[model samples]
Target: MSRRLTLLVSAAALALIGTPAIAATPGAVSADFAQTSVWGGGYQGQYTVTNQSNHAISSWKVEFDLPAGTTVSSSWDATETVSGNHYTFTNKSYNGAVAAGATAAFGFVAGGSALPANCLLNGATCAGVVDTTPPSAPSNLKAGTVTTTGVALSWTGSTDNIGVTGYDVYRGTTKALTITGTSATVTGLAPSTPYTFTVKAHDLAGNQSAASNAITVTTAAGSGSGSTWPLKVAPYVDMGSWPTPVLTDTANASGLQNFTLAFVTGNGCKASWFNAYDPTTGWDRTDIDALRAQGGDVTISFGGEAGTELSGSCTDQTQIQQQYQAIITAYATSRLDFDIEGAAVVDHTSVDRRNAVLAKLQAANPGLQISYTLPVMPDGLTSDGTYIVQSAASHGVNVSLVNVMAMDYGQHDGIDMGVKAQQAAQATHDQLKVIYPSKTDAQLWGMVGVTPMLGVNDDSSTFSLANASSLATYANGKHLGELAFWEVTRDRNACNGSLTNCTNVTQQPYDFSKRFEAFTG
Candidate 1:
């Protein structure tokens, strides 16, 4: 017997002192045998042995009978001797002990070709003989709606002793995905196609449950068709300067679809501060509801030459992404415009960094519509000279539109000369169409500002409304998108002299009032 047997007997003697002592100690026996842990093709069972006599037992032997189909692979804490399906366990000196009220534990591994039942330990019955193995093979496996690009599948959760971990998703026979919690989004699927999906669950012990019911999904058809382009004309209106009477005008006297609020400033211009957020005052649910009532889209513009918080050095990609996300979430709008003309003052814009910012913003707000206000550069310059326009195309950024600031190039020294700015805007639109054929014509827009000034009367050396009208006519001829003006106040009689000869006026109504019908025609 092991030294532990002696200690158990001594301990038992002290506990049974007050009870009537039996002459002979009952043989130690155990019940409640169970497989605690299991692996592929192997398992371990544990049981407790207790003495039923008033006296201490020094040496104890346990005889266990394995159910059919099972064999004693190994034993521990005792000397095991086997005979057919029955086995005898002689306690080791260190463990051979059972007091009157004391119990001892012993365990062993059993191997079997198939799972066995009716197992017994020391000729006593066991309870809680659970199957620690994984769940049975999942049945009713079938595929649903198969698409060329993507497939969605769902299955029943696997049963297990502890609980099943998440599922492992498969595409065909190959393991394509692993979903821990639940549900997986298999993306990058081809359009107008079919695919199959399968899923299965696993337990903590790496035992996999049966596969779930298979499902399939087909991608929808492409949006573009034929040679006809999906051209959209979205004009930008300054919300800060919109006439309260016109904004509140339900009669639709001034035909406009959307109004944008300038919240940020750039190069000391008349633009508002970029980081200024006042949804309740600057904009609120009331404004959104009103715009919706008028069949208009309400958007906010960031970074103009002289807007607030826009003149600082370029912020890190993370800060920019955070700001965009917060603003979008706060305003509950998916449309965004980056008026990045000031980027020229900073370092040459990093395409990779810009892509990262766009990607981060997209991740935070899926299906976001992003637009860039790019400088209208003349032809024969490095593509980077156009910044956002070329970069977005090269990086595959999902830009909804490119609003070309056709008027601002004159504000810069290089290409500020007359006729050159208009020619630059025209060249930009032509190049963008050729370079990015996949982008819709609606994605290209012409920006026209209405300041109350005209070029030299006969010289045409200066910039004025006549030039803007010429550009608008050109844009219309090309079937390009609409044009945007700066502010209603600047274009009104307040800035321009009267509305009679509003041909080259700054106010949207005055400038476009007479020209609107002809331009749309």
Candidate 2:
């Protein structure tokens, strides 16, 4: 429940190269630039030069453009070369030759203004005049022939008065390749990982064109997301509920590898676990650590039936967003469930605020997944529930999963609970058809999920062991997005009375959990 500050980078201002100072024959000696910044009395800089022969190059004016909050960083010894109006940069042979042509290193150490992050210069060639006009941007950059380890890329060529001589291909920020043709393949990438690429053309006069439109492409099969659950079946566990269940013990007992820890509420615009523990201050982390140690992961779910969800309690949207971000970062979780049931569903203002935060988070984090857990009827999502999805879509928040609370649907006579749950899912899918008419049926199925109450539900209908097994089968057959139950603690017990702690009518200790855990997709 606090504010955190992050510094981005001290980046590129200018790259002014000078002639090599030698008596006989002048050649390229050293192309070094000094970039300085002060962050908590610390300094760091990144340097990339084509070649340096240790010549005392003079008259090179090093400039600084410290753009705040730009990205990718840390604090190191400012490498303090000198102080005052001038700077002398001493180089460190940190990394070997980057790619085939560039020598990359870091320099800078002086007391100066604090700067934000990630600045990069394309490249330059020493020219007599340094021509002003660069070529037009490359057109229609596209990816083709993707493999497990590489992807082939091609783009339409650019033209200018001086004429285009070469093309520069970029993988993210780093220049990956330079070619005469418009097509090349970037290799040595990890499988199943997403990569961003762009293309820019340059003239013989050393003027680079603006980069073309970017494309994000993925390599085939396998995962790079370490220590997180890579599957689709993660059940909910009430962290603030009775019995205060141990996660590691639960995993060992039920053979479940993934769990969704629930209910990070708010206390005066600060995130709290039911107003009891501050999530950022290492609260209830021992179990989480132990669970991760065993190759299992937990999704940190915010906003439950608990009264003050962060958005509802806090009018300041930024404050609420920061708390949500902090919790996600603290857990290193890819999955986040917003349980927008119980009053919060109808709280449209809060819903919009939450959606805005989610949209930003998704855009900033490429791999982070977001889902909405809403109350559902056998017929489908209520009007309020549909509005939540509609608003999220309108705000540019891609809904990863729409999980339905398939429990407590009043009284039903003689109908199988599993069939009722399926009905709710089908109805919801049909509703999604109206909302996202462009999406295929299979695509809609992938967005649907159902979570039912185990053992005896609050209403007259009881979700029996048969119901759990049958529901899992249906979810697998449809290739659904996810399958979760209410709370693990309730399923762990089989006692009478005490609705919150135990499932009133059931057979084995964790029959329902085992059934749902069997879901692999």
Candidate 3:
């Protein structure tokens, strides 16, 4: 390849990617082409997808026409369905569920000048389906229960030609909330002030309907929390491994009532305990019931280092949501943890889907807490782990805590394991401050959780009993959200050096757990 050609490719790619496609019809799904690279014979290109509808879409397929002799060699992040020069790229299972007002994209390497014609997204024109009619106005708008700073409202939905996307709830002329549901709570109001609200329907092409029936309501005289998540001091227990974790016995010994059970992975769109025990059938109900009987509870973890997460198998958003909802209902637990380590942390499609699903779960079940236990280093979370948290925040998931698996730094060179865990927590707190700028210093610290591998790490360093004590003291001083280790069973056995059956150091059973049990915010 010519150096000049490389330079040309870079410039052309930048210019082409920067060019925007004018949407002829607003609020409609559209796909825009971008040339990412160039060569003498062919080039690499990409298409950015936009979902302008007020409601989310579960899947999308983009098809376009290329001139004779122009062909696609390969594609990624989307499944390709092609015949000759007509190329159709459909969303993969993980990336298919694009939220309302969200975007998805795919890329490909091709054999020509890098532009395509007759672009269509799910059989509609690339510019978006051109429909000019406005939706019917929402009917029977009425106020519901009022709080000190907010008031709830609901109304009958509207209809449209191209399909009604969502509704805009207006607080006297100013748009208060844009929501897909007919009901919503308008917050941030004076306690005793009366306000009038109306709603209007909107279509896919950005057409707004007439104002709905108005209603006035005065907020009550006291404050109440809105969509809150709980803080927990739960430690992890590997339920999938042998011995299967006698929860009550561990709880009895460690005096740690809260447990984060490991891994409820997918059994083909269904929830399974590491693909062995079906969670819905209450396979482990006896242990959970006994644990709960002792005034303790468990947080069902959804993903781990092994097998596939639900989104990897359940392509339908509704089915996946049901799968998760069933587990929550079955366990009757308020907390959920997503252990995203290994390759799952960097998988953006599943990350986004998980965040979206958790957001909905939180909405449906208020005070439902969610956390991500991610891979970390002494310095901080890797770039991929940071992106995982960023995606959750962007998707409106209420993150109760971000637990860093502070283990397995591959170098042996005289590292202070305790100091490394503290540094990682501090660094993660700082990153979170950037992601959530409005949160206070105290709030950011409260969102931190540090989990170091006990006994001997899988690397050159070791986490001794003293290190656990030091980390717990540090966590308590900062009011960190949680303190946990890799597995509860390992803390019981006496063994040496990086074995799952035992902590690599000499210690009595429950020594590590007892140290971390006192951690509280």
Flag clash pairs in model 3. Answer: 456-504
lDDT of 2 by residue, 331-390 (tens): 544567888878888899988988888888877665566788898998999999999999
Better of 1 and 3 by TM-score: 3
lDDT of 1 by residue, 278-362 (tens): 4312234344434443445445566555443332334466655555555564444555666664544243444456566776676
lDDT of each: 0.48, 0.68, 0.76
Order of models, best lDDT first: 3, 2, 1
What candidate 1 gets wrong by more than 4 Å, as runs, is 1-235, 239-253, 265-276, 279-285, 308-316, 343-346, 349-352, 377-385, 408-422, 433-470, 497-509, 513-521
**Model 3 lDDT tens row, 391-442:** 9989998787889998898866686788889999999999988988988787
lDDT score of residue 449 within candidate 1? 20
For residue 460, model 3's alpha carbon misses the true position, in angstroms, by: 3.6
Cα deviation at 256, candidate 2, in Å, is: 0.9
**TM-scores of all predicted structures:** 0.44, 0.58, 0.57
lDDT of 1: 0.48
Deviation in Å, model 1, residue 43 alpha carbon = 76
